[model samples]
Target: MGDRQDAETFNNLLAAFGMARGKLQLPCVPALKARYVQKVIALANLLEKPLTSAQVEELETAIAQELAKGFQASQHSQLLISFQPNPKSVEQLDFKITCQIASLAEFYEAALKDNFATDSDQLDRLETSVFGKHANARVLDLLPELGDPETTTILDIGAGSGRNALPLARSGYAVDAIELADTFCQQLQQQAKTENLPLSIIQGNILDPLLRPKLNHYALAILSELLVHFRDADQARLALAKACDAVSKSGLVLFNIFLCRPDYQPTIADRQVAQVAQSFFLTPAELESVMDGLPLELVDRHSVFDYERDRLPSSAWPPSPWFINWATGRLLFDLEPPPISLQWLLCRRI
Candidate 1:
């Protein structure tokens, strides 16, 4: 353990753990764990001396601790990974452990079958936990660019809490909001009444046939963060087509879509998250293909982050919620194998 080779071997093991750590989600954990085990063996072989049972236990426990930390961070999408090597931690490991180390794969497998309800209360709790009440300023900034605010008739599809709808209505534009969630629809209606804003709050699915006839002739159609809920690409395309049809000839439609990494396939955890959302993450090319034959033309494509960074509080630091988001965005920008990106697509009828 005195030689530089010993130190280097430990570093390699830690680095391999880091690599496998990234792939520790439900579907890929087994394969990734195999790679992690290989690294553990490589470290043992490098020592040349046979490790005592105590040493082996210590090493495995240390790795498990780090993996647990990673698992906790992964639960929050806003977290930025801070990967500082803790080589000294191995010295602190005690051989007092009697229980078998809990498997990361087991945790993920059980999570996949989690019985959390997707009811209104669950949705409300989930939304409250992950996001704040503030609407994205980028969506608001694009409103004026679409057309004049005074006379424009804006239809907000899936307008949760009237984030964009209420603001547009308050700005003197006529706004119609369609929300499927009963609680959200009621809240939006109550807010609009309090503000005395001109808003039409329809508590129903945006695709409902009865709602379609009433949604027509809008100057601007806002579909922000809604396309991801469609069952598939074909359905997304149909939804986009419907949004286009609802707008006037001169109107524009703005929506958001998530683009997956070109090289990396989604893991089971990724699919599970998408399934819960009723969404599919597509690559930019796949999204383009979905809209290929549609009459709608892409007017502009915006990076959601570009408009959001400045809005972050200046005091964010030490991994605050906003800091984590900023750090995650920065890391992904420079990440060797890109993950996924949330992008805004602005389109107009031909």
Candidate 2:
């Protein structure tokens, strides 16, 4: 079948690529298999029309395994690649990669361009407007309030599009922005280069072991609009612990949590829908419980909607009382309430 042929073809191509390097015993030239690798990838792409999603995943896995093998073999043959594997360390053991959203850059970019274009103001700004005013601007406001920008360093976990980081950098603050999306990282790098911003963009999971040594160096750490994406409280807690660990004592750590409406309760169907969406909302009390022992102290909490209402048009006034009463079901005896918008929590590393 095509799946079997896909695997065999990949292995054969890898072998040929390795052999093309003249037995792989001499000095390894850079990109020795670049041409053949491209060929293999093209063949895999060609199969896309016939392969199911599962089949495509299986094919990619086989290709990755074989590619890894080719690289490993080149070492034994004394033909080194252009790079070396990183040294493993204990910090890696502390943080386990529970989830890795694949093709995150592409997915996020598409979502931002399509789904959020009308619904989100964050995506509307100059493309580099990675951070919107409601949630992100509030987080950014603390930078000037903290002290001198020259003396400060900020670590922005999930620094999508450098929205917050770029502004901070322009203000003469040092920023270390970590993002998982490759496309976003590239965009950030391009923007930094174009604007000559003092932003260091790191493209990797924030919880990577290689980043542990650099964790505690920041004076300000921001996790803007990110926690809601986690599957549950425990996973969010681990991420928070890692963020706290990366900051010095008394360093400012800021993040936002999407709070469920006070009266909201989900039915079985509602929970199923949320699971499909991969979004989990937590109450303020639930968020506090998760941060119980972390080396952080709750400093400021703001309802971003209320805090930034001035930005809206006169026509965009607060929700009508009728709608609110209806949503809360004050007219009825009992029913679950709908979700409120966003809530932010600002904490300091204790």
Candidate 3:
């Protein structure tokens, strides 16, 4: 920030605030609704010099109190917000806060790092993290649908650390694993090599147009626990299009997606908020709209939690501590029946 011009930095901050609140979904968060959007202060005008440590804290408090007004009603929870600075540049912040309210800026800051990019340190923590802590219960249960591992080929897009892919390969199914994070790819590669599994690791983003896999080549494509990471329903749409392109005719695509209730109309801001909380959500209608013209047919959709719960033994009620919270939409809300939930969806190519 020291290197950036003040004006540029200020503009960026303003944009971040606007984005965090969301222009399209502002109504969902009443405090940040129409009038508030027009009233956000230009902090630049208030401060001519750099902020002192104490001043920053004061600002954060004041801001959090305001954001809390909306946050309390905005469906956000008091989950641990994490941050990891670059090992070289910024000093690491080793701190945690528990409070009645958290500012939108705090969430915005956290969202910036939530993406497990090449530079992010999340890869080192994925194993300890609840994500991919266990092979997706739905993916494991639905494996037989792919049929004849000896001859079937499977594509696991966004395959983090080979959670599902490794198990499939070990079962003798030829697997192609695509991942966006370098460390995750390397982790999967090392494990695959150790067992000499038939899994091929590809380091790429499924969203990249140039990262094309063979068209109509795979018997099945598994995208379990991945779509919610996409920026919006549109990005999910693109990935599904790619999945449709990769699976052969009559082949299938199975994905675990977080979806809002059909009757629930989430504002764009609501979706943005969901993403910041480590979940990206879409409506069933939006999903149908995505696969509308594709050569894909929706075969079935089941509640992920219900399927896994009814199958896994009582002792293994939740595969991980965060599994129930995340899979049932508690990550975004504390409701008994969260308006959103994870769903196991399967589609077949025409």
Per-model TM-score on C-alpha atoms:
0.56, 0.57, 0.65
lDDT of 1 by residue, 1-350 (tens): 45766656676555345421111122212213334444554544453323456666665565455444543333211112112223554322222211122232233223323532245455433323223345555566666666777777888887865657866888889888887765566667777787888888877666555666343588778887676555457767767777888888867888877677677676755543453332346766778888988778888876555545566344321212542333233322345433666567888877
Model 1 local distance difference test score: 0.57
- Report backbone clashes per prediction: 0, 2, 1
Whole-structure CA lDDT of model 2: 0.56
Deviation in Å, model 1, residue 165 alpha carbon: 1.2
What is candidate 3's lDDT per residue for 1-350, written digit by digit as tens? 57876656666455333221111122223333334322322322232223346534654554455445545533443422222222332222222223233333344334335644334465545543535445667677667777888998989998876667877899999999988766677778877888899999988878888999889999988897778766667788889999999999999898878888877777766675676565788787887787789898888889988998887667656766678888899877766578899899989999
Estimate candidate 3's alpha-carbon lDDT, on a 0 to 1 scale.
0.68
| Cα lDDT for residue 72, candidate 2 | 35
RMSD value for candidate 3: 13.4
Model 3 lowest lDDT segment of ten: 19-28
lDDT, model 1, position 191: 72
